[model samples]
Target: MAARGEVSTGVSADSEPEPGWLPDAAIVLSGGRGSRLGGTPKGRVRVGDIPLLDGVLDAVSAAGIQRAVVVGHPPSLERAGVVVTREDPPFAGPLAGVAAGLLALPDLPGKAWVMVLACDLPRAGEVIPLLLTGSPAEDDGAGVARERVQGADGWLVVDDAGRRQWLAGCYRIGPLRAACAAASTEGPDGLVGLPLRAAFGRLHLREVPDPHGASADVDTPEDLMRARAAARRSHRERMES
Candidate 1:
């Protein structure tokens, strides 16, 4: 597994394999201070007419995900067909959000695959199929349990710039639960302040390339502007087609 914040370059090409099943649910992490955006929740921020949360939910829905947990308390997201919940103590970070998501699930044991995404990305939905398609190969080990335990767990997107987007991925539920458990114990806030890379260290990951930049997300006013412009362009293209 890759260390916290380390960009991995050596994940074997042989690990890529076709998905055997569709994702059962999604955990959309939405509880961030958006401190750079001056305390505005990124999920509530708009790129054109749609809030970021709506866009993410739309993508999740489009991917055929029946259930979704938005790990934040945005009224808009609750109305967007997601189960809205917040990390304990509020703003406990993405790892804690993951823990909350797992707990909120009614049948965590029944789910085989769960998509995990950040709420800030306008195009977050577009990358989900890529994650689903780039699952770990069966030959990686003799058994599913053996492969995952040996670190072949899930699929994460690597952006065009070659940075790993931890929030834009799909994970096997059992391994994800284990990883979240390990990650949540690393901090006082139930992994509230722990960086994503640390949590990622607990799993074996396969990198799915983000060829269309679908993992691009808003972190600042300038990013919002760009996202809106891109949304406009995409809308225009769709209308023209």
Candidate 2:
């Protein structure tokens, strides 16, 4: 955790994972103010005909994860068919949403790997599966160095520019829960006010490179427009070829 959207490197993945290895759950954060897009809920915004959140959820489902927690306003998540939760006092920020989402899951053992994603990733369906490929298991004994915990703890995808995308990573539930618990102690509002970077710094994280450039998340009006254009372009390309 450097700052929000800051890049940090040093951790690396081990050998390829066993066949059929995948996360057991996903936590999709949908609670953004959309201040750059006129205060609209980013989850509710449509890139084409599909809502941004829907696309992300579809990707999660396609990746063989049935258990998902969507943290956002109830109204926006009503029909998503996943656990819809919200951070207390609302608009607390991404870390608070992560806490809320973690709280929504049932207590179960070995369901350690959890995929964390943002609602605005238009290409989530394709990108998420790619991220899951060749992931290291928690028991790999990769050892921690320079604050980087190898194996099971989790790996996040970095963009082409080698920037780590905190919201677009997979994490181990045990460490994630512990981090949330520790971050909750900071203020009367609990984890709601915690910056994601500050909270995640507590975990041992590695980075995966995103060569396909599918981790783009819509944050501004221009981003929305680009998403729409990309969707249309993809559709046209598919129809033509």
Candidate 3:
């Protein structure tokens, strides 16, 4: 088992705050099987003029996350540009990919927030700031877990709300690493899904408005179409600006 907590690059957080934001790096989880797309690599799919991973990387860039660690599957990781890695055990699922990312860059010297992202999202780029802002630091190794309202209210809130989107989470790598390692027992089911919850029951989750960008993913062809339209709209706004 490869210790996924090894940091070997410049992605580490520095002692001084470059600007006003907490220095951090994004560990994008892009190794999932786009089952609805006939097993196509969602990261390669075009969302507007750029590939899915491009949009994700841009989002991380905009958030002041200078460095990125992409954990993709097979040739998907072979893409040119940016720092990329692959799943430790190939297609073992998103958890495996996430673990690979955590391992690839451990002890980010200056970074505090490790934004975990999925590649199938169409609007994640526009919606990540909301999660990064106002999020509390995990003074302890627990982490900043989001909680929402009651389950009956729906599965979106950030608090201990009977609802939450575990995948679209951010945290300090220390606790997250320990939690993930402990959750390894659950295999793919662990990590950002159920096992993560089990390991860190007392996580510090914050609640947002349940932005669709953080929740929606391009799974099926219909989803792709929707994502394309959204992406085009965003691109147009940027071009006009």
Candidate 4:
């Protein structure tokens, strides 16, 4: 574990096998104003003993992504390679946070992909493999194969309720940069308060289904309780195994 403000490069000992494809960098959006949670920073909210932000960081590290920029306030993280930053003007929405995170990341090839994650998810690590591998097969009666979206701008996760979780997607860096640039010029606020849908509207995206509810995020006290319960269940399952 890293001390406050220190960097760590250690990978999770229990991390699953590395996928054939991995994002070169990750952008973690953590700047939301947890209004529903009584002004508490969601990143600092613990799902069990681990802070939500740390849990998200662990997921990123477990995926073998060395470079990550966390945009918002987060507790001291155990992983060394993670960078902590904030959106310009503070409280600027997730779009601004993504732009800030991109700026914080070292330059990489245009073809390199970046994982964009929101820091409120408890089971974020479980979805990484699904995003990396490709979209999940459609649930039609016929058995289908999971196919990668070639030349697509990115892969976005569709939660169990069929809503797209834009912040949980993996994207090609080039298109993402272009989208951010275009989005910055859209209004006087630049990326501030910009909706993620508008920013990535032009890019083609493959929808990956979240069958395991991995994209579920904490938004309220009730949500947090559910997350805590889920975490306890996971812990028990592990212990039993």
Candidate that scores best on TM-score = 4
lDDT of 3 by residue, 1-241 (tens): 1112222232222221112343256777777677778777888888787788777777766665666788875243433334778875567666667677888876563224566777766667655765544333332322222232111111112433335555566555665676667777765544544433554444444445443445577778998888788777877999999
Instruction: Note the residue pairs that clash in candidate 1.
Output: 92-192, 151-204
Ranking, TM-score, top scorer first: 4, 2, 1, 3
TM-score to true structure, per model: 0.80, 0.82, 0.68, 0.85
In terms of lDDT, the best-performing candidate is 4
lDDT of 4: 0.77
Please give the ranking of all candidate structures by lDDT, highest first, separated by commas.
4, 2, 1, 3
* Alpha carbon lDDT at 53, candidate 3: 78
- What are the per-residue Cα lDDT tens digits for candidate 2 across 140-220? 443222222335467787888987788888777778888888878876878766788767888878776677788988988
TM-score of candidate 4 against the unseen true structure? 0.85
Candidate 4 lowest-lDDT run of ten? 10-19
The lDDT of model 1 is 0.71
lDDT of 1 by residue, 45-66 (tens): 8786988888888877776666
Q: TM-score for model 1?
A: 0.80
Better of 2 and 3 by TM-score: 2
| lDDT, residue 196, model 2 | 87
